[model samples]
Target: MRIEMTTLAEQPVAGVHICFFTDSLEPSGLGVHLLNLMRWLNPARYEMSLVCPDTPGGRWLMERAACVGAVVHPLTVRDRRDQASIDRLYHILTSERVTIFHSQVGISWEGMLGLRIAHRAGVPVRVVTEHLPYLLTHPGQVAEHRETTRLAHRIITVSEGARRTFLERGYPAAQFICIHNGVELPPERPLGEAARVRQELGVRPGAPLLLTVARMTWQKGHSTLLAAAHKVVARYPQACLAWVGDGPERPQLEAGARALGLAGHIRFLGQRDDVPALLGAADLFVLPSRFEGHPLAVLEALASGLPVVGTRVCGLEEAVADGETGLLVAPDRPDELAAAILELAGNSELRRRMGQAGREQVAARFTARAMARATMQLYESLLCEALGRTDGE
Candidate 1:
C-alpha cells in the first residue's frame, strides 16, 4: 500500500489532493469548519476530499461535499482498530495518491487508527487537529494522545488553552499550533425572517428572547442553564429560553427543565439550519459549556450582532470580552450565570451596545477568510518542506 512520492511537477494537475478524515458527517463545529474550508480554500491549489463513515448520519455532510465539488469517500468503520476499515482507507489513500492526510480528532483512538493507516500507505504529510483540550483528563488517554501527537507531522489546536493542556500532558510544545476557529459573517436577516422565527417559536413581541445553540449534554451545562432559566423566568415572566440543538441528554434535560418549573418557558428546537435568523430574532446569546475549543457558535452569535453570555472557560474566555461584547461568569455557577443573563435581558440599551461591539469584534478578527488564509499558509509551508521546494522555485 506504499505510495510513491511525486515531485512538485508530477503532482496532480489540479493540485495537492488532501483527504480530511472524520468519524461521521453529522453537523458538528468541526464539520462546519471543514465545510467552510472547502468553500474558502483555493480549488486551483488544493483538491479536497472528505473520508468519513458511511452512516445514515453522514449523508448531510456527503451532500455538502458534493455541493462544493469535493470528493467524498465513505467507509464503514465499526471499530477503531477494524482491519477491514483500515484496508479500505489504505486503498483510497493510495489509489488517490493523497498528498496530505488531515484528521479531526473527535475520538483519539479512531484518529490514531487513521494516522497509522495513512502512515502505512505512505502519505507524505499527516496532520491532526485536537478539538477538545479536556480529553486528556483521563489518565489512560495521556499515553495514547502523546503517541498520536508523535505520529502527526503537526498537531493543531483551536485555542491557546488547548495547546497548553496538551503540552502539559507531555506532548511536544514545538509540534503544537493554535488556530482559532472562525465563522462566516452572515447577512442581515430579512425583517420578516426574524419575525417569522419568533412567531414559530411562539415568542411574542417585546419579550426577552434568550437563545443558546448547543448540543444537549452535561459538558455543555444544560443543567446549569436550566437553573439559571428558573431565575430568569421568575424575574421576567415573559422571557423565553430556546435551545437549538439536540443530543442524548434531551430527555434528562427536558425532565430537569420541567422539575425546575421552566417547561413552559423553555423550548427545545432540536437542530435547525436557520441559526443566523434565529440569532437575529433573539435579544441575547448564551453558552454554558464547562469547556470548549474555540466554539464557532460564539463567533456566529457575534456576527449576528447579539451580545453573548458565556461561561468563563477556554474558548469562551477568548471569544467574549468581560464587559465589552458580553459577560463571562464562572462555569456551573447558576446564580452568577442568571445574574449576567438578567443584566443583559433587563437592559435593552446595554444589549444594543454590546451587540454592536461584538459585531465589530467579529469583523476585525474572526472571519472565515482569515482562518482559511492562515490554514493555507500552513499547508503550503508543510508541503514545501516535505518536497524540498522553495518559494517561487
Candidate 2:
C-alpha cells in the first residue's frame, strides 16, 4: 500500500484532497469541531474525507459528514496493534490519493497509528490536533506521544495553555501551533422552548436552574461539582442542578447524589439533543473540570448568553475571563465553586451583564468560521511547503 510521492505538477489539476481521521466512536466535542471544519472548508478549493469508527455512536458523525459532502470511510480496529487495520488505513490513504491527512487526538497519542500509516502512504502533508494538554503520568504513553509529534508535519493544540504544555515537554516549538476551539453561535431558541425544557425537567418558574453539560467522568470533576451542588442547594432550596451528558462515571455519581440526599435538588438529564434550549433556560452554566482543552460546553453556554462558573484551570481559564464573562474558582474546591455559583445566582443584573459580555467576546474572537479559516490557512501553507511552491503560486 506504499504510495509513491508525486509532485503537485505531476497530478491532474483538482482541489486539494484532505482526509480526516479520528478514533472516536461517540458524538463529542471532537465531532463538533470536525463538523465545523466540514461546514466551513471551501469545497471549491478542497475535497474532504473522514475515516472514523463504524459503530452506532460513530454514525452520528458519519451522517453529519455526509450532509456536508465529505466522503465518510467507516473504520474499525480491535486494538492499536491490529496490523490489518493499519494496512486497511494505508490502502484507503493511497487509493484516495489523499493530499493532506489530518488526525484529531483526544489525548496525546490517540490516532497516532493513523498518522504513521499516512506517513507510510507518503501523504504530502500530515497534521494532528491535540484536543487536550499532554499527559505527564505514563512514561510509555509519553514516549509514544513524542513519536506522534515527529510523525506529524504540524501539531495543533486547541488552546495556548495546551501548546505551552507541549513546548515545556520539549516538543519542537516550530512544529506546534495554537488554535482555539470555536463553536457556531446557535440561533435563538424557539419561543417557549426554554419554558418547555424547564417544565420537562420539573423545575418551577423563578427557581434557579444551574446547568452543567459534560460527561460524567472523573477528569470532568463531577464529584467536585456534586459537592458544590450540595452546598448551593442547602442555601437556596429552590435551586436545581441539571446534569447533562453521560459516561462510565454516571452510575457512581448517581449513587453519590442519592447518598447525599440530593435527589430532590439534582436532576440527571443524561444525553439530550436539546442542549441549546437547556442553555436558554438555565440561569447560569457551571463546568467544574479538573483539566480541559478549551471545552465547547463553556463556549456554547456563553454563546447562549449564559454566564459560566468554571475552574481556574488551563483550558477553562482561557475561555472564561474571571469577573467579566464568568467566574473562575480554584479547581477541586467545592466551597469556592459553591460560593461563585451562589454569587451569580443571587444577582440577575450581574449575570445579564456577564452573559452579554461573554456573547460579545465569542462573536469577536471565537467563531466557527474563525477556527476553520485558521486551520485551512495552516493546511495550505504546509501543502505549499511540501510541494515546493509559494503561497502566491
Candidate 3:
C-alpha cells in the first residue's frame, strides 16, 4: 500500500546512482540513517548505490549495503586529502554510469573528490546532506560548503537551523532544502518484554530510568547531561541514567559521574545493537545535544513509545514537541535539563501520555516510507530535468 504511486516502467529509476561517501558507516548514526532511508526507497522507482572510504567501520557498511540488495561498489578513499582516492572515485563514476550523487556527509576532501567525479561524469544533479551543525564550531565546513555548493545543484539539510546557517554563510539561498530525519516503526509485538529487558539491565522496578543513546561527544551535550544526572541523583537516588553509546568523552564522563557520587546510579552501556530493547526498558528518553541534524536515536526512542527531554537545538526542535510530546530546555542548561527530566521521571502518567503522543506524531509525519517517497520525488524531478521530460529547471 503506497501513498504516491508511479509505475516502474513509466518512471523506471534504473540509471540513478546514489553514492554514499563517508568515513565509515558503523560508528553508526548518520550512516545507519542513510542506510535506513536507502533500504526503504522503493526499488521499482529508484536504484541505490553506496561509496564509502576505507575505515575501521567500512566493512560493516559494505555488509549492510549488500544486505539491502543494491548495486554496491566499495572504494577505498584515503583520508580526505589524498589525490589517489580522488582518481579512483572518478573511475567509479565513469564505469558505473552514475548520473546522480547523494552524499550524506559534509565537505571533506573525500566528499569534494566524489562531487568532482560526479561533475566530470556529467551527473546532472549532486545533492549533499548536512548532518552536523556548522555555524559555530565548524566554520571551515560552512566555507567548504560554499566552495562546493556552486558545483552541486542543491543542498539537503536535516534542519532549518543548518539551512539558515548556510544562507548566513554565503551559500546560495535557493539551493537548500530541509528534509527531517525519519524513523521506521518498531515491530508490532508485546511490550511486556520491557520488564525483562529492564531486569537484565539491572534497572529496579518503578525506578526512573532515563535513557540516552549517543556518542559521548560535545555536540551530544554529554557534559550537561552528566551535570544534570548529579542533580537528578541528588533528588531521586533510586532514579538511574543510562548512556548507550561510548566515545572519546567516555572516560571524562565516567570521571564526572564518579566525582558527582553517581557511581552506582549511572551506567555506561557502551555500544550495543539492542537499542530497541533499551528503548523498551527506558522510562524517559533524554538527548541534551548542543546541536543536531535530526537525531536518529531519539526518533527511535519516540517510535518505541518513550517520553523525551531534549534541548532546543537544530534537529531536536523537530523531534520533541514543547510540553506536548516531550520537554525542551535551553541548550547547555543543566539546571533546566535536570528539572525537565526529574519532572517526567517523577510523573508516570505524564511519561505515558507524552510517549503515546510521540508515537502518534512519528506515525503521522516521520516514517521511513514518507522520507523515501519525498527523496524519490526529488530524484525524479532531477532526472526529469536531465531527460527533458518536465520543466524542473
Candidate 4:
C-alpha cells in the first residue's frame, strides 16, 4: 500500500491515534523496531502514524510503514531549535487528535524536541523509547536527557542494561521500562537456498564461513573485526567473512582489510536483502559492537540458528549468554576476539549446541509478537489512567 495523503475531514479518527516521531534519517535498527511495532499492533485497536524526515532514507522507512497501514507524515527538523518544523509537528498532533505521542530516540536528545512538542499539544500520553544505552558524558546532552525523562510519561529501554544506565544517571527508576527488542523469526529456508547464497558469495564448501550483519561504522567495531579476521585467516587459509550492511566507515574498512592482506578472505557486501540465506550458509555469526541496545542483528542471527560472537558490552552482553549461545570478548581486544572466533570455528559440535540454544531463547522470549503485546498493554494502561483523570475532572 502506498502512502496516500487525505484531508483530516475525510478520514475520521478511529481507535487510538498514535503518532510515532523520530529524527533519524536512515533505515537503521530503530526503523526496524518501529516497523515491527506497526506490523504487530492490532489495527482494530491502534491507528499508527509516523513523523520522520523527508529524505530518501526516511521515505524508505515511510513506504514500509505505509505497507503495514501506518499513515506517514514527512517533516524535517534541522535541530531542536528548528521552530518552524516544531510548529508543523505540533499542528499535525493537534489536527490528528493524537491520543499518544511516542518518540523513538537512538541517541541522546534525538527525539526530545518531539516529546516537548507533544506535551505542548496536550497529547493524553507521551512516551519515548530509548533504543540505545545511555552513556551521555557531555553536560549539555546529559541535561537534555534529564529533560526528556521529565517530559515523557513513560520511557522504554530496549534492554535492561539501557534502563539501568538511565537509573544510574539518577532518572526515576519507576518511569523506565525495559522491553527487549524482538525479531520476526523466519521460517526454515528452502533446501539449496543456503548453497545458492554461498555460491553467489564465492565461499567454497568446507571453508569456515563467518557472517556479520551490521552497518560499517566504528560503533559496530568493524575495524576490530578486521583485526580479528587478520588472525583468523592465518589459522584457516580458506575462511571467508561475509560482511553485510554499509556505512561511512566502509571505505576505510575495505582499505584496512586490503592492507592487512585479508582482501581475499573478507567480502564487503554492502546492504543485502537476502540476510536469512546468508545466515543459513554461515557457520558462525559475529558482531564486535562497542555498544548496542538489544541489537536486531544478533537476534536475527540467533533466530536463524547461527551461533554469535559479540563484545561484552551492555546490549550485546544481555542478548548473548557467555559460553552458551555465543562467545563474548572485551571490546577492541583483537586477540581475544580472534580467539573466540577460532574456538567456535574449530568446534562444529559446540557451534551446533550453541546455535540450538540461541534459537530456543529467541522463540521463547524475543519474538516480535511478544514485544508488541507487552507494548500494547502499556499503551492501554496509560489510556485507562488518562480516562480516569478525565472522568474525575
Q: Which candidate ranks first by TM-score, i.e. highest? A: 2
Better of 3 and 4 by lDDT: 4
Q: Which stretches of candidate 4 lie over 4 Å from their true place?
A: 1-14, 78-81, 389-393
Q: Write down the lDDT of every candidate, Cα atoms only.
A: 0.82, 0.87, 0.75, 0.87
Off by over 4 Å in 1: 1-14, 24-27, 78-81, 107-109, 137-140
**Residue 222 of model 2, lDDT score:** 87
Residue-wise C-alpha lDDT for candidate 4, range 138-193, written one tens digit per residue: 89978877875687889999999988988987889989999889898889899998
For candidate 1, what is the total of clashing residue pairs? 0
Q: What tens-digit string does per-residue lDDT give for candidate 2 at 1-393?
A: 333544432454357899899986664888988898789998899998999999876788899999999999899642667777877887788778888999988877578778877877878889999899987678887887787669789999999999999999899999999999888888888999888988888888888999999988888998998888877888888888999989999999889899999988889899898888899999999999999999999999999999999998988988999999999999899999999999999999999999999999999888889999999999988877787788577
Clashes, model 4: 0
TM-score of each: 0.94, 0.96, 0.90, 0.94
What lDDT score is found at residue 288 in candidate 2?
92
For model 3, what is the C-alpha lDDT against the true structure?
0.75
Least accurate 10 contiguous residues by lDDT in model 4 = 1-10
Q: Candidate 3: misplaced stretches above 4 Å?
A: 1-14, 24-27, 76-81, 106-110, 136-143, 189-191, 391-393
Cα lDDT tens digits for candidate 3, 284-309: 89999887877888888889889889
